[model samples]
Target chain A: MVKVTCPICGGKLDIPEDSLPGELFEHEDCGAHLELVINEGRFELKLAEEIAEDWGQ
Target chain B: MRIGLAYDLIRWEEKALAYTIKDLGHTLELIHVPESVFYLTEPTIRGLDVTFERCVSFYRALASSLTLEAQGVFVVNTFDVIRNCGDKMLTTAVLAKKGVPVPRTMIAFDKVRALEAAKTIGYPVVVKPIYGSWGRMIAKADDESSLLDILDFRENMPSPHFQIHYIQEFIRKPGRDIRAYYLWGEVPVAIYRVSRNWKTNTALGARAEPANLDESTKELVIKAGEAMGSGVLGVDLMEDEDGRIVVSEVNAVVEFKNTVRVTGYDLPRKIVSSTVEALKA
Candidate 1:
């Protein structure tokens, strides 16, 4: 498991080891949607982009 | 076969699709849209049997698929399908030409003519922008004043696309609509997006329930797909007061998250497997 900190709630999140860079996850503690971003083998979490006007099925 | 998933933001559908591709023992390439740059003329993207366009934004999906397709990479739903489905006017026109049942629709370049068309179509008309999704900017005008009020807002919009009005007769549906997943020539699964609200889009907080497809509905779904060039489409249909089904919209980059939750079907796997299998044929 990959451990990361939730930027919104300062809570730790257990992410799957196989999670990709662009994968999105929601923080259970604060309900903040996050994006898992990896660079130089280091993992960081950032708030996911808000739904765009043109977003839908 | 090598596969690429070009995405703006990876949602549940994207992750499930990627896992399905990997689990099936195919090479998976994740093309993150925001960080990646596409060379239009030079063409750096290559070597993928098929690339799934999963971008949330219709414009982003269209541009990304166009770039990859230019490099001879086969894209699901194709550029033409995306372009056609992205615009409400094009979707309605294409479906109507294919003999598919569609709501009575009219187009006007200006707000005054739009109000005029709406008046002709009668009250309780739906005014939609040429380009939008998730029921954004879709409004119902119960009468001329309401329609004029709606048109007044649309006329002042800076974007020319929003300036053009596409009006349709409001079909009084049964508090829900059918959302069918059309893959290639067949509809593997479908669900009813149920809500008290007139707009039954799941993105607008509708509840999804598994819908058994009848023969007539299935045929309509397939026809809609064929009309849109047949590649992964979300064919939405509504039952009018007269009990006739009409094609409400066809979506190119369809989301299956809710359908999976309600139906317990591995839609991502089905979509991936069928797409890759077709390429091998």
Candidate 2:
């Protein structure tokens, strides 16, 4: 399992080993939605942005 | 509980679904559609009770839904529903057969017959691709000259589908159209996409205003959804000069950002709740 920290609340997350980058996860303790990412092989989490239908016509 | 999201690109709607799943005490998996390979047999995508189909491309959405369903994964806006709502020709046929009021439409495969069909429908008819959305490639032939010019462009197009002339009578509405987000055939919210232009798609910068449908209109919307199989969808309708509301189109993969904004309703919550309920059944 990949261990990461939620940027929104500093809560630790045990991300799945199979989880890919750009995968979204929610913090159990802080209840914050975050994206599981990697920078230089280091796990990173960023608060997810709100969904928008920018492509809607 | 776990929910899988089959998506091509990340959009606000996807994020909302993920957030809602999490808030509801479930895990959300973002299974990127372009990267996930569909297996003809056995299992490929696993670890989910159900999946929310959110691919922007109609072809991808339909194919992915079929593959997921094959693996016993419940997909919102199921494969059959996607196909029925995504194709204009099939959708119109269903609506007409169901006695759901829709614009008078005719299709022809050749340029000569296309002109003839347009004349029969009278001038100022709409020429649209059999498969498309967002008001793209839709032309209004106001007269014989405009119809010929539009057909000239369509005839020379390389895509064979474009060569097929899908003609429909353009209902003269009062500078706006109705767009309602139906969660399993229930219209929780509706909005008016007001545009001075003939095309009132919100993608073209149409202003949104909260609206409500009358009793009859609600029945028509439900019938349209039933014709395509039930799931979360966007149903489009228009009011003619005589105040008759007619079903224009049904979007299987609908965008509800504007509806949420103007109506002040928690659409994501409602959608997630509906999804959870469907999964249980």
Candidate 3:
């Protein structure tokens, strides 16, 4: 597990070793959804895209 | 086999599908749609056996599927399925033509004719954007005043897509609606999106519970799938005031994560395996 801080809230999140890039993890404490991204060889967390009007099932 | 997964946003469904495909020992390529540029002359997606179209946005899903399909990649939920299900009008027409029961719907191009159509369908009708989901931009107009108010807002929208009214009869449902997973020819699992609000979309706080599909529902769902040209589909059904099951809409790029959670069904695995079977065929 890799430890990272929630960018939206200062809470901790544990990313699984098998977690792939573009997979989403929710910060339960802050109720924010974060995306797992690999930037410059390091895995980082960023807020997921807001639901756009065209986004649907 | 080499498989491609085309997606705009990675949700639980996408991730589950990706993991499932990997677990099945298939070579998986993630086609990030936002960054991947498709050239009309040159096919970028070469050597992939099949591509599962998982784009949440209808436009992105259709555009990517068209390009990928033209490149000779067999897209799950082909270009036709994406195009038909992306627009409610097209979905309704396809279902109705196939003898599948759908809510009475009328299309109008302008506000005046829209009101006329609404009056014909009777008041308290549901106005929907032809191309939307998750219950967004859906308004129930109880009377002329309410409908006018709704139409006025749409009249000024920048996109003409909003102006093209797709009005449907608001079925007096039993405080819930059905969302069934139609894969290829089978209805694997279904859930009742129960909500106090009239809009029963899971995205809008509707609680999901496992639903038992009767033979009639299973048949209807399968028929609807056939009408839509097959793939992974989410068929939304609602019981009308007269207790008849009617198809509310069909989603080509259906999300199954919630259905899996609520029912404990291995939908992602099923989807991956089924997609592989489709590839072989």
Q: Count the backbone clashes (under 3 Å) in each candidate.
A: 0, 2, 0
List the RMSD of every prediction in angstroms: 1.7, 7.2, 2.2
Tell me, by TM-score, which candidate is best: 1
lDDT, model 2, position B240: 97
lDDT of each residue in B115-190, candidate 1, tens digit only: 7898889878999988878888899999988888888888788888877789999999999999999988889899
Q: What ranking of all candidate models by lDDT puts the best one first? A: 1, 3, 2
What is residue B162's positional error in candidate 1, in angstroms?
Answer: 1.6
**Candidate 2, residues B152-209: lDDT per residue as tens digits?**
9988987788877899999999999998777776878889999999999887789999
Error of 2 at B251 (Å): 0.7
Return the TM-scores of chain A for each candidate in numbered order: 0.90, 0.81, 0.82
Model 1, residue B273: distance off in Å is 1.6
lDDT of 2 at B19: 77
With a 3 Å backbone cut-off (N, CA, C), the pairs that clash in candidate 3 are none
Name the regions of candidate 1 deviating beyond 4 angstroms. A6-12, A28-31
Would you list the C-alpha lDDT of every candidate in the order shown? 0.90, 0.83, 0.89
Per-residue lDDT tens digits of candidate 3, residues B1-281?
A: 88889997778888888888889999999988876788767856678998999988888898999999889988998999999998999999999999999999999988889989999999789999988888999999999999999999999999889979889998999999999989888888999999999999998999999999999899999999999998889999999778799999999888877889989999999988987886677
Candidate 3: lDDT of B191? 98
* TM-score of chain B taken alone, candidate 2: 0.96
- Which residue pairs come into collision in candidate 1? none
Candidate 1 local lDDT, A7-42, one digit each (tens)? 998999999888888788999999999998988878
Ten contiguous residues with the weakest lDDT in model 2 chain B: B8-17
